[model samples]
Target: MKVKTGTLNRVRIIGGDWRSRTLNFPNQAGLRPTPDRVRETLFNWLGQTLYGKTCLDLFAGSGALGFEALSRGAKQLVMVEQNRPVLDALKKNSEMLKAQNVEMNHADGVQFISRETRQYDVIFLDPPFRQEYLPKLLPLLPERLTPEGVVYVESEGAIDPGEGWEVWRCSRAGQVHFHLLKRTHA
Candidate 1:
């Protein structure tokens, strides 16, 4: 419940016993966990039929997205985070929630994508701003996503999806924008 290092930013676990309960995260190290309003909007976009779906959370800072997916009834979740301290914090959070279906991986996001052979129903990507990892990340997703699956990318502004995807939705919330893409055929 207490995330060390900075001020505690309270978050609620969506659609679970702890739903609406306040959970805290350390705000240091530029760790701005996604805003709750955005998270609620994202899940609403996903709908209530998310139960039993497989989810991949890349750039899993604070593990909020993946945890929310699971809390909303996602059957399985794989969170890939490269930073060591963040990964440790994520593991602790997962344990605190007693989420047995979650798998935590510490590795560069790109490497994790390349090595993962399984497909997921939903993939959440929130790479660091201006990193332009989208171009490099998009090509590798076809093999990792189920047919008709969606990839959600959150960035500073609009993402053009220049390669390997057909944009399904592009919307903005304040300073952040999100692109939801479906894989293109080979």
Candidate 2:
């Protein structure tokens, strides 16, 4: 379950401006980047273009999802990661890509979400699989989205949208269950 630290691993940008580009990340436990097949499916569900959208990548491990959004024309991307090494890699990749629209934050995902007042067009939630973050986080997302916004959640297994949220799309790849969720009434 844990990859050796200090090993070099990289993920490729599957489409958009940075297509075929690679970004390196440290091999840290639970630091899984969204896999290529899963990301391709998720982006397809989101539509290929993210033009002018504001996105938040909470629990951003490798910055894969956020960077992909930026590459696809998102207006802005905010990535929050609490792990120091992972955060460093994210910063390095942001600079490496000349990502002017990306913002990196070092903070706990739940704490950051608690204090954030601005809503996002898309929010990527890919927390550590061992933690029960979904139960607490799902309830907080509806208020954090724009009226027509969506939230992409990746977990170890299938998860319900809970209460006011509805599943826009859902799929599985290996051990990951990923879903695009939207507020039912919004």
Evaluated with TM-score, which candidate comes out highest? Answer: 2
lDDT string for model 2 (1-186, tens) is 546878879999999999999999998877889999999999999899899999999999988899999999999999999999989999999888999888889999999998898899999999999799988888888888999999999999888878898888999999999999989873
Worst ten-residue run, lDDT, model 2? Answer: 1-10
- Model 2 residue runs over 4 Å out of place are 1-3
lDDT of 1 at 96: 81
Count of backbone collisions in candidate 1:
0
What TM-score, over all chains together, does every model reach? 0.88, 0.97
Task: State the TM-score for model 2.
Answer: 0.97
* Tens digits of lDDT, candidate 1, 98-175: 887889898999989988899999999998887778888888988888997999889988877866688887778888
lDDT for 146 (candidate 1): 92
Work out how many backbone clashes candidate 2 has. 0
Candidate 1 local Cα displacement, residue 6, angstroms: 5.8
